[model samples]
Target chain A: MKAIITTTGKDKTGILAEITRYISDANCNVEDISQTIMQGNFVMIMMIDLSRSPLGFAEIKEGLDEIASRSELSIHIQRAEIFEQMHHV
Target chain B: MINSKEILETVRMVDAQNLDVRTITMAVSLIDCISDDGKVCAGKVYDKISRYSANLVKVGNDIATEYGIPIVNKRVSVTPVSIVGASSGAFTEIAKALDRAAIENGIDFIGGYSALVQKGLTDAETRFLKTIPETLAATERVCSSVNVASTKAGTNMDAVKMMGEIVLDTARLTADRDSIGCAKFVVFANAVEDNPFMAGAFCGVGEGECTVNVGVSGPGVVEQAIRNIESGDAADLTAVAETVKRTAFKITRAGMLIANEAAKRLGCKFGIIDLSLAPTPTVGDSVAYVLEAMGLESVGCHGTTAALALLNDAVKKGGVMASNHVGGLSGAFIPVSEDLGMISAVERGALSLDKLEAMTCVCSVGLDMIAVPGDTPASVISAIIADECAIGVVNNKTTAVRVVPAIGKGVGDRVDFGGLLGGAPVMKTNAYSAEKFISRGGRIPAPIHSNKN
Candidate 1:
């Protein structure tokens, strides 16, 4: 399954490193990455393939949520199909 | 890959604009649960609901987490209990069972403790209607609705008269709770079978064994979308309608995805998506605010009905093609208590009961979640229902009355139900009595348009 992981917060050091390390540890593959600064905040969108991950979708979300709460960032991991359904169709 | 901006837009809609699947309602038909013995039937009803919807909450939560969108409620709607419990005359007992099942399964509210007496009533239905007040007061999560009129059958003046007394009785019974019982009951004209919103949803006789209907809401999203339009073009009604339609299409598409996935996961037939811009008490997430954003000084002002008409029509136009099946009360909801802007308008003395009645002609529902003075008579309440029914019947649309007569309370007072049910200021009803009209108990003949056959 493919999903999108979006991270948004104030600019901080090692933000990408922290996220990628966590993603790799979960056995998920990053398919694409886009990062930018918008309206004075750091924004990153990662399209990730979760087919290889042993962890369930809920478990992965919980881990991401823990990172978000600790780092004061807004993080969301959602099935990519939702975007395709909303935007493409 | 989807563009970055569109991805963030979806995220912002949820994170900032309160876009959500308002409800994931599993409609369970209780036709097979019927038994001549009321107790036996009640047992079967409970068992079927508990078994069929055992995974509803879990699946709803799972989808909410996976999709990163809020699923506000997980509820169940069953075949009208009046039909299921009629043979046994065990209406209240079945109400208890529905309430128990709701609590046990972690469901929000169980609907369809209802009857369909649009033309006339049978002895069993009449007996069942009498149990509503006590039953509503007794149950914690059971919701009741009565269909007293329809375009095809005209209006049942007798049922309307009875419902008026029943609404007051319910208010007095639950007076301690700010007459909250009335919040769980609604009277409708031209009620739909597939409505996922409550307290009006019921798995109608025409529905299949089981289905999953999704209600999507995003008043804030639509409001923000309109607000995002350039200020110069904001004055243009055509531009406003276009924006609303496009926003509605996106919202409905998301709803379609959720509904189909929920049904697939729950192993049930997929029902329609209700594209209602339902409001919450939160400041930015209000349907009234959407109207206000459309250049209205206040929601109940002179041009409010026209604005609501355009809004309601555009929503259906945009949403119809996004989902294969679109049913339920699919338009803008203006439940005063559940909308912060509406509550504020009433408090500011800008909105009134008469204006609300006029607004319902073009909106999704009628006189919803409004509170009236305790001294209001049942005949007046019946007259109110009759007026709304006349609008619905004559116009071939659905209208409903869910007014709460706050016992011991008068105009300007507030009755709070908290959470999504919110609260409302007790508005004044007219001083005139309609006892004579309501006393002439019979059916109002069907409108001429309804004579299609």
Candidate 2:
């Protein structure tokens, strides 16, 4: 259950902390993190192993959406394999 | 130590801002490989190209990764394949070999399977030009071009007429895949050599054996740079030009370093640097955004021309200072289907073909990425190409038409060529016949400007 999460949208404070806390509470292990600012917006791409997830994909997506709404951001969660298949071509 | 919050905020800004280099193209001219023996010439041509461009993809990829910038495409443009094929009588084989070389070297597209027959054609030129359809259809990586007229040479009526047939033939041959052949072919009236831009770059006969040209683009970067400028301040033409010039200068310098490095590594002569602000299919990476930044409600409006002219001039002035050899059509491009802002403009009824043509009079490439109805007559398309070419010739600048007449699609219909073709909304054209006018094929005399002693 390895996943890559990409957060993009309006720039605001504590976005990274809130998302990381959510993942930590879910018992997911963070593998790598990278972020960049482009065109006046903030984006973060995090690769995490969710093998010990407290919840599955749907629950994680729902939880992340709630956090994103509160922070005024957009969150996308996809399987690492899916990301690789889509981009590595 | 850098604060984590500060670094995260910076990352967000970089992604949202869409700061990236669109392409890093290597121009390799094959003019010097000319020889009397056809087989010997083909072998030399292949060996020369392989040796020169072997490391191009690797170098471009390393630089892109090093800078963390997305260099989306790595391409090569040669001296017109026609020039290389003229004496050798190896047009088809040479085209195949060139395509193979590019594919093996991992380049995206290889251009200059071309001919410059503005006034008249040589026997070799005619044979090479006629084979473009077959060559383009047979090869995946090869792109082709033809220059039918120039201000000095006037317009070649015979060549223009022949191109009409050629375009129709090429389109028909590749019609199964939405006429992808036309995607690889462009017909020019005032085609310029030393253009780092494609699918119309050819090493003009006037250029050195090999030279480096840079095509720098940062539409999204430039757009973001001016986003916060007040509308009142943005309305100041000089202020807007200065901002654009500064951004263009930085982007051009980056390209210059890469071109010079690639040239040195390849051991070929470095050429001029082209400072074109090429846009991509992605959102925010658009020339129209640059125009919108200048306080224009939309591109193709009345003030668009003035804005574009100033921007083009400022880019040239700034870029000329950054690099000694600045050539190619170094300006903005207003292609209808290519840029998201432009597509939105068309959808909003703010942009039209005529207005686009007028914009090209000052911008870089002319009448680019326009989509017309599937059933549009070949003659009408030729007339359209002729009119645009006439502008290039009259203005003594490079002008080209990369129009896609999507089969089975009509006006207002959208055809998605996907990826870089973006989404082209079919534009309406006048139904009036230009058959009588285009049918009378004769050369248009070179403009008076070519009479230099």
Candidate 3:
């Protein structure tokens, strides 16, 4: 069970640190991270293993609400199978 | 790792556009439940439905939560009641039992209060067909259908006439709710057995003992994708199709996952995924909006059918690879009342019934969710059915009629069906009666195209 965690918003310091702390608290191991700046917005994508995570997707969504709202970031986390189903097949 | 753009695109599809699995339909065969005694048979039918669909709604919600997508409806289809209730003439009891099962199991609606009379009517079928108006008026979740025509067997004008009167009776009997009972009945031509959408889903006689089918709906996603990719002069018809095909592939895959999980949880075999761009009353989620994305001025415009043909074919090309088996009406549905764009077009005089009939030849479902004047003659209604049926029969596609003749409502009046069924402005019908032609009561012979066999 792999999932993708993505955030897009204005650039800021401690952005990666804040995201990493949330992942650790949710007990999900982040395997990869990529960041880019496009059209004056900061975009970050993370690959994580939800298989061993203590939190379910709904619970993770609940826990990320404050981080997303306070940081003014549009965040989305869902199973990677949705994307792989389209692109790979 | 998936690309950042792709992840963002999916989020937009889910969060902004109303992408959803329209239905997860369990096709439960009642072959084993039929008996000589009406009471025992009705009991058996109820027991079988409850046994098979006990976990249907639970499993559907679980999958929706896991995938983070909404599964809008969970329903069941059974063997056509004409056959299941033939021995004892227990059609009403059987309908009641199906409704009880749907309520108890949390299924939205149960279909297959239906009869197939393309060639001719059997004694049992006539008896069952007589009970449709009363049964539908009495029950909340039972849908009934009658197949009045087919290419191979030709049109049964007798059945068509009976269906017209029955539809009128249903409307009058349920007139208190804006004649909404008529919305639950469908008259079909070349109707497929594996349809997962209502008011036309029924488990075919040839199907297995039990199967699970899924109907995937996402007109808004396709519309949004078109909006995102559109640029000046660089994009053309072919590019538009590729975009729709790609989006449809993704939607179909998501639906298949739910179908597999739900079928597994309920201990049934997977049947098929209906690849239809079913619309809703919501503004953005209209099939007409998707057509407008292809640069059409209105859905009933001259070039609408060509654009729809492209969209319908593109969706199939994209969805075909994602599912193990694809059945039902696998194309775009242009139900007028359920689509905001179509409703606006009709209300503003940009669309008409004649043009809509032309559009149905290239779409999945035909002449669907349209409301006509209250005094529209039954013979005229039969003529409409005959015309739509001919399109399906000659073209070898599945098409159906679910017109509501709003009792005491005429042109420009809107009838509210209150939910996903939506509301429709009463569109004008052909004033010239086809009664003289319809009065010639016999099957219209199959066209030359159907002579392949």
Candidate 4:
């Protein structure tokens, strides 16, 4: 299964490193990454493969939620197929 | 991979626009549960409902989590109890069984305490119809409906008159709770078999054993999409219709995905995706607001019907392309109490019963969640149902009435059913009597179109 994790907040140092560290620790592979900064606001979308992850969807989401709560950020994890279904024919 | 912007847009629809799978109803057939003895039939009905929907809630939650989309309700729709309980004539017993099974499965409501008497009522069906008022009052989660008219069979004036009295009886029975019982009951014309929303859903005889039906809603998303149109094209109805169609296409596609996933997990057939933009009391999630955003001053004002007609047609056009099977009430809903904008419109006297009736000609369903004075005559209520049925029959569409006669409450008073049922102010009805007309009881013959077949 694949999931898209979105992060949005203020731009800051080491934000990318911190988020990747958590995903790497969970044994998930980040297949694609895109990030942009607009007027000091940071936004990033990561497409990750969860097939090899030891953690369940809920467990992985909770960890990301905890990280988001500790920072000025909003994080959401959703199955990638939802995007494919809605945006494509 | 899908583009980043598209992913973000989908997330925004869920997080901010109130886009959701309104209900994922499992249609369970009770044809095998019929028996000669009332108690034995009721027992079988209970067992079948419980067994089929045992994992409904858990699977709904799992899908919600995985997709990050809110699934508001998990429910069950069974074969009409009148047919299943005809031999036993155990209408109340079967209703009680449905209520218990709904609770056991952790689902909100179980529909199908219903009868199809568009042509005429059978002996057992007539007996079952009379139990509706008491059955609704006795059960908390049992929803009931009666189809009294159809284009092919025309309107059954006899059943229509009976339903009018039944509605009043239900209101009086549950008067202590502001006549909440009527909120769980509906009267229909040209009723669809696979409707997932209630109090109108029932597994018609035409349906197979079991299937998953999904009703998706996204009025807020549609409203916002129209709002985002360039100012240069703001006054253009063509642009508005285009925007609405595109948004509805996206919403319906999401629904198809959820319906397929739910049926796969539940080991049932994927029945259909009800392409309806159903509203909720939540502020932005209103169908009325969608119309208002399309440049209407109020939902009931003069051009309201035109705006609603455009919206309803655009939704179906867009939705039909996204889903393989688009059934149920596939258009924009305009229920008063369940929509914040509609409630506001009524409070300001900008909306009225007459205007609502006109609007129903273009909406997915008819005069829903409206409240009238307790003193409103049963004949007048029947007249209202008959008029709405006439529109559905002539136009070849489905329409229904779920009005609540607020017992002991007069005009200007409000009846609150809370949660998704919402609340509505008691609006005045026409004072003229329809007693003589109602007294002429018989089937309103099928329309001329019926002869074509």
DockQ for every model comes to: 0.91, 0.04, 0.53, 0.82
The global Cα lDDT (0 to 1) of model 2 is 0.75
Task: Report iRMS (Å) of candidate 2.
Answer: 13.4
Please, what is the TM-score per model? 0.99, 0.79, 0.95, 0.98
lDDT of 2 by residue, B1-453 (tens): 223343333233236655454555566667778887777777887887788778777776655443334566777788787778788778988888888888888888888899888878899998887798788778998889998888777998788878877777777677676767777788887777777776776667777766656676667767775675555444466677777777666666655666676577656677877777777788877889888887789887889898888878887886776778777778777777779989998998998888888887888778888888878888988898888878888887878888877777788888776777677788888878999899999987777887887
Stretches off by above 4 angstroms in model 2 are A1-89, B1-14, B35-39, B231-235
The residue-by-residue lDDT of candidate 3 on B1-453, one tens digit each, is: 477777777777777899989999999999988898999999999999999899999888777766667899999999999999999899999999999999999999999999999998899998889899999999999999989888887788888877778988898899899889988999999999999999999999999999999999999999988987876664888899999999899999888877888888888999999989999999789999999988988878889889999999999988897887989888999898899999998987889999999998999889999999989998988889999988988888888999999999999998999899999999999889788888878788877777775
Model 4 CA deviation exceeding 4 Å by range: B233-235
Model 3, position B17, has a per-residue lDDT of 97
State residue A18's C-alpha deviation in candidate 3, in Å.
5.4
Candidate 3: pairs in clash: none
- Winning candidate number (DockQ): 1
Among the numbered candidates, top TM-score falls to 1
Error of 4 at B319 (Å): 0.5
Ranking by lDDT: 1, 4, 3, 2
Chain A TM-score values for every predicted structure, listed in order:
0.97, 0.91, 0.93, 0.97
Model 4 lDDT per residue over A5-66, tens place: 99989998888898999999999999999999968888899999999999999999989999
Clashing pairs for predicted structure model 4, backbone only: none
- List fnat per candidate, in order: 0.85, 0.00, 0.54, 0.72
Q: Evaluated with lDDT, which candidate comes out highest?
A: 1
